[model samples]
Target: MKGASSEGRFVIDLPDSDAALALAGVGNQTLHSIEALTGASLVIRGLELVVAGLPTQLEKAVGVLELIRPLWQEGQIISSVDLQAAFKAFDKGYKEDHASLSDHILVRSKRGIHLRPKTIRQKAYIKAMETHDLTFGIGPAGTGKTFLAAVLAVRMLMERKVERLVLTRPAVEAGERLGFLPGDLQQKVDPYLRPLYDSFHTLLGMEKTNALLEKGVIEVAPLAYMRGRTLENSFVILDEAQNTTSAQMKMFLTRLGERSRMVVTGDITQIDLPGGVLSGLVEACDVLEKTDGIAISRLTAEDVVRHSIVQKVVDAYARKDS
Candidate 1:
């Protein structure tokens, strides 16, 4: 298929140079991915897009392009997730579901940066967060569980939907010994919450993030500090809930006050608790599986939007565990 297994070519005209480049991606890498995945050679010449190879392959590749046309037509950047979603539609014959994946923007920053769900499960997760007062997002790393929650929280704060945003996590080490580290309590705890802060910094620049923090509009603290307080009119996120004890999870969930929203996100497979301790995230999911006014969005390796290798790594580990 790489060297022309069949004598055929398909040509289609794009609307403009922007759409052509958007479809081809930077340095034509998107075309390379499409070609490698579909066994069709794809190239762009000005506004004319060419697909060459076996007739069936050409048709399939063109079908994928049509499915993802919603993105490129809007000058949106497409990634491996988009390609995978397209291939999934091609195989399952669910093109309409795949096409709606790019239909909505979750949030946009002041600098014109748009953040949206990269997969179907993510879209559902966002919707769950919007509808439910308390939601649990269980998944592996790189699934955007906590990141999406942070983006929505930021949007709520900016739009005055919420009075403040509170980001908290259990102060648990992940397979690393931190007891001997030389720092105060806050200094020692900063590293654990750094990832959550990184997401805010990306959505809002460092200057704006610091300003919000200084104004107390955004609060980052450990879960222990959340005890004995009602978080009213706030968007609260508890990261790494898998490390929380049953009592701790119950305490955190009870802290939800009127007009407050809470999201608990964690990866149960990566729990680093003591041998006999149960993960609060696991326990909560089991207890609340049938509860009303709450949602549990479980993302899998397919929902991972990081580099493709990360998905492979998750799948490999999952296979070994299974």
Candidate 2:
């Protein structure tokens, strides 16, 4: 009651009971964003947050907070209108130079894309993709590592900046062991690349995507298949790059021919390579970070795009590691 609104008044209706409980998990997020945006305190009790600030700033904060309410507990499909509106509400002067991709890719109104990265590192990742021909988005799981890469790749392909799209991921098994994963090479690698397929399917629609795949306009393959290949005039994405050894990463990087751009995204935190083996993605990042043409983008737990709880989960583990 201390910080109860003076003028700003709005009620946020969550979807259901599950959403309400989920919202509780991220109660602090509202507080943090309000403090950052309005220079005021936010107190949340149950599903309601009492935000005290100047009326105009509080109203703006209220609207921006509502845009992400559905995402407090779990990832939801947020409409383009909602995303654009949120961007406007969250706008602070000239858009940060590090948010180029976010500024360019207009998510269709009412068509939800499950991504919400709220840190300088995450914004840098978007900026890198916009400026580079070959980029490595390296970070931890749930950090929007692969999904954001795929989304940018799709947007570039749609804009004709690239002639086609290709996605590939290493098929290495972590602990479960893939010895019994069924079928042959394609079957084995399919599971690892399924996330890429899911994102593409959601963004491009199934029929058109299938048609593109059939015509070889969109190709998804195992990391091994990328060997001895030269990709030109295409937007190629390599997911799960951490599973790849140094040699394989080198080969994949070399495959970037003229006029082609590639995005190799992986979480070094989840590399599945053997103890003595070095991950190519890990190595490439070190080397490329020193180079001129290539871009190296790093995302942190603060950029987790899943549920807000997912961000906390990542942060908890990071603290343990430290």
Candidate 3:
């Protein structure tokens, strides 16, 4: 390793070529990403990275690189998600050493792909899930609300914390009628539940997921199916909850039986309820805002971890709505 320093610039030498390559990404794409994110001029020569910028920008850039170093050492494939998360953490003065922010492993896919929260709000959401029997994750699209809930529910089932995983959502369509559709109740609701199935498939693989569904270890159904039963010893997730009416929401919440956990996630702004009908999610948040054993995590556009343009799009719509 080598070192060089000046008034406003520094050089970090990476002795291991593989680690350096991992950090720089293929074709220097990661380096360019870091440069763009931190507004720092970064040049890679051999295994050394020379960073030059305003003193504060350079310091933050180096902080991000240092934060990611351990992930690379542990053979974790760094992605743009990692970069964005690191940048957001530093920019917001969030304590970067939190385990959920970097090293917490939520679940491992059947193929060994590790999934974890990619933002601070996501970390908070996961922590809430662990601590509270009921948690509400309200956020915009791409904030990982439904996805994380599904992952945690699956993990709880595998760990024996829960006997079953029940996933449900309202079958409301976005200004579309379901009366003209054919087939039985399952067929009518399967389309609305496809997102939950996709999450299950990603984490458990298609064959295993189908097997679990067949055995009833995993159940995906419309919210209407929850009417008359107490969900006991189960990890239940209500997705697209904003589409639920007040009565429906109350019914769902009261269905939580002993030794059960419920995670309700929805985007309030995207509610598809009939005109003048208040969303159950909105009403529940208002009523439960201060209740014990209930956690509410509000994620904003800044927590949107999809493509970069998604944050911009959310911001644009938010501005327009305002």
Candidate 4:
């Protein structure tokens, strides 16, 4: 049996080349995750590993290493069962005390909106819709900000909470390169709003979604066309709010009419605005945070509902920012 120690080089002598390869694959996954999660360094030499970190981190790494050892046995397939077990055990031990979004939105219907969030952020967002005529969700990406807002807008339209559903985004490109596109205004702007199309297809299915669009019950338009009209008694969502300049944002907000609500969602980290232009979403958040009828909820990487590794990467980037 290989000895478990406080700090040292460890060698797990293997029987054959296949076993060696399997062990190395598992080790690489574990080491990469550990380094990403805890800023540890792992140096691997064949079957031997030189792990350098604080004692507790090294102990945790060793524990993970030992857990994957049996799967590396000759003729054993390092199967999904082993990986699931290891990840599940680690997840169980590391209960995410950070608030999660498993509460407010539920996956009631089968096809549309697969995720159900039951956390404070989601409830707060929903409540903001109920109370305020306009709310902004500014946070990191993959935090269910845009998706949940879209679902809520759909529900409002379906339940007659609002008269219509209006979805739009800024048609800004990486380099102001709209003229180079292969189509006219609507077609050119369509690509920027692809995410909205995807969400709509998932929620309403293709035929009904098309019918609703034709009837104007569901409108997908570019921000430029939004300048002349006011949206009333409707649920309006401005996805990718970071791309909207402060002036554009204010114009959109002022276009809100009676019995209407606007849910603006964006990741400040991903702002594609011109170098000096401040995002309307971020500026609105700063100005309206303490206002009576407005709500702003910020989500972190911890609120990411995607793969666990995504959370690790987001956290690593956030640390780098700090």
Candidate 5:
């Protein structure tokens, strides 16, 4: 391997053209992503990569490349998702071996999508889900709150830990009124529940999801329908709960029965409840913070795993609000 001794810079010579191509990705997108994430200037000349920046950033960039190089060398394809996880882990002061971060697979979807925690908070959230009967995932969007909850719920159902899966969400609109919606009650509320449906579709293919829905093994409905039912032996997830009123939240929580697990996910900052209406999620947390068998996992912009700009957008709005 070629090496450079320039101050605040390092050069790594790839072992072969295939390894270099894998590291660089198609059109050098992978190299560009690393540069953007670590604030390093990565330039490729033949099979050689030159990383130049501040000492710390250069070090981080080189370290990330070194951690991922083995995967590529072993003929494993590294995607942007993998790189993002590495970047987040490094940024969050992860001291463990980086390979461990990439190796911790949470779930493998039917379509072969491997889901894992992209940040430290996410790792803790997954642990909380496993250890607690009720988990409150309070966070900003794109933090994998609902997605991970759905993944766990599907796994539980497949393993027969629960006989069924229940997914619900508040129907409160951000600003629009639902009165103008078309079709019957189910149709009116289906739009609000589409996100949960999308999650299940991702984990279990559309065909199997539809079959389960038909068999009543999977139920996707709005929070209003949960008023008078006792959920037993099921994995239930309440998404977008910030819009629920105090009474609604209490009712939903009370429905949890024996052999059941519930995950409540919401972004409090995006609450759409009417004036003077207290959000059930916020109030429930205040009341249940000390309760046994319940756990809360709070995720922040640092836990966001969407497009990198999403994290910046969350930070920008947070700064404005503060």
Candidate 6:
């Protein structure tokens, strides 16, 4: 089964030279990845491609290629996300599921880049947030937990589904003491909330985001500011919940007023809480998992859409920890 027979050779006629180039990627790296994945040889000449391998390998190679056909067929460069997601789709359902994953666009930036779910669990996570009043997305870094939540929250605000958008995160220091910083309270904590600010800047253009911030349509604050307030008719996102204590998380949850939606996202594995301190996010998952009208999505490394290396890094650390 390892050697190719004459019958094992299958030639595919590409639409044109552009299709061939797009499918093969720059320097044929994508083709090489496909070969590595399916144990088949893909040779593209002009507008023809020769796929040679065992019969089963040929079938698998062809099936895998079909999952990414929609992008290549449109002359779009197949990215690592596309290739990786295609491989995942191949292992799970097939071409139909791949199409569905690519079609669930959350928001398009001013650059025309479609912000969409890059994995099936991401799709489910987005769905959970949309359908539920309170949603929790617990996952590893680079899984788009907070980015996707910001996207939906902004979309809802624009559509008047929510009166305002409030983004808060625990300003807990990972290694350094927050009090040692040389500034007022806001200045000291702004660094901790920069990631949340960047997400909004990318979602809405810089000028609009600043204007909204000035008008209080968008508010970014440290979690400590929400202690005694009721956030009504707002979309509230509590990021970095892993740094919150049980008391802090309880206060934050109770602040969710009527006609509001809340999305809590954090990487429990990356908890920076002091030793002996329990993460509120961890405890809340146990407490509210069975509560009515709440949805919790736990995404693994499989859902990481960052550079493929990030997934490897996550898995490597996980192995060491285990």
C-alpha lDDT values of all predictions:
0.87, 0.69, 0.86, 0.70, 0.84, 0.87
Ranked by lDDT, the better of candidates 2 and 3 is: 3
TM-score of 4: 0.67
RMSD (Cα, Å) of model 1: 3.4
Local accuracy of candidate 2 as per-residue lDDT tens digits, 1-322:
1243446543454445555544433544534644665565556545555565677666666656554554543434333233333545357432333233244433431255444444456667777878888888888777777777777777777788888888988877723565677777677667777888788787777887789889988999888798888999998898888888989988999999888888888888877788999988878888878798788887766556566567678888889988
Tens digits of per-residue lDDT, candidate 1, 1-322, equal 1222346887877888778888988888989989988999888888888898888788789888888887787676778877876887787787777678676687776556467777778989999999999999999999999999999898888789899999999877733455666687666778888988898888998999989989999999888789999999999999999999999999999999989999999999999889999999999999999999999999999888888899999999999999
Candidate 6 regions off by >4 Å?
A: 1-32, 39-54, 73-77, 92-96, 174-176
> Can you write out model 5's per-residue Cα lDDT over 207-301, one digit (the tens) per residue?
99999999999999888899899999999999998998998999999999999999999999998888888999999999999999899999999
User: What's each prediction's TM-score?
Assistant: 0.91, 0.70, 0.89, 0.67, 0.85, 0.85
Candidate number with greatest TM-score: 1
lDDT digits (tens) for residues 1-322 of candidate 6: 1333578887777787777888889889989988888899999878777888898789778877777765666555777877788877876765676678666767776555567787878899999999999999999999999999999998898789998999999978833677788888878888989999999989898899999999999999999899999999999999999999999999999999999999999999998888999999999999998999999999999988889999999999999999
Give the range where candidate 5 is weakest over 10 consecutive residues by summed lDDT.
Answer: 69-78
Q: What overall lDDT, based on C-alpha atoms, would model 5 receive against the true structure? A: 0.84
Model 5: how far is 126 from its true place, Å? 0.6
Residue 96 shift from truth in candidate 1, angstroms: 1.2
Instruction: State the RMSD for candidate 5.
Output: 3.5
Off by over 4 Å in 5: 1-22, 38-58, 66-85, 97-99, 174-179
lDDT for 24 in candidate 1 is 87
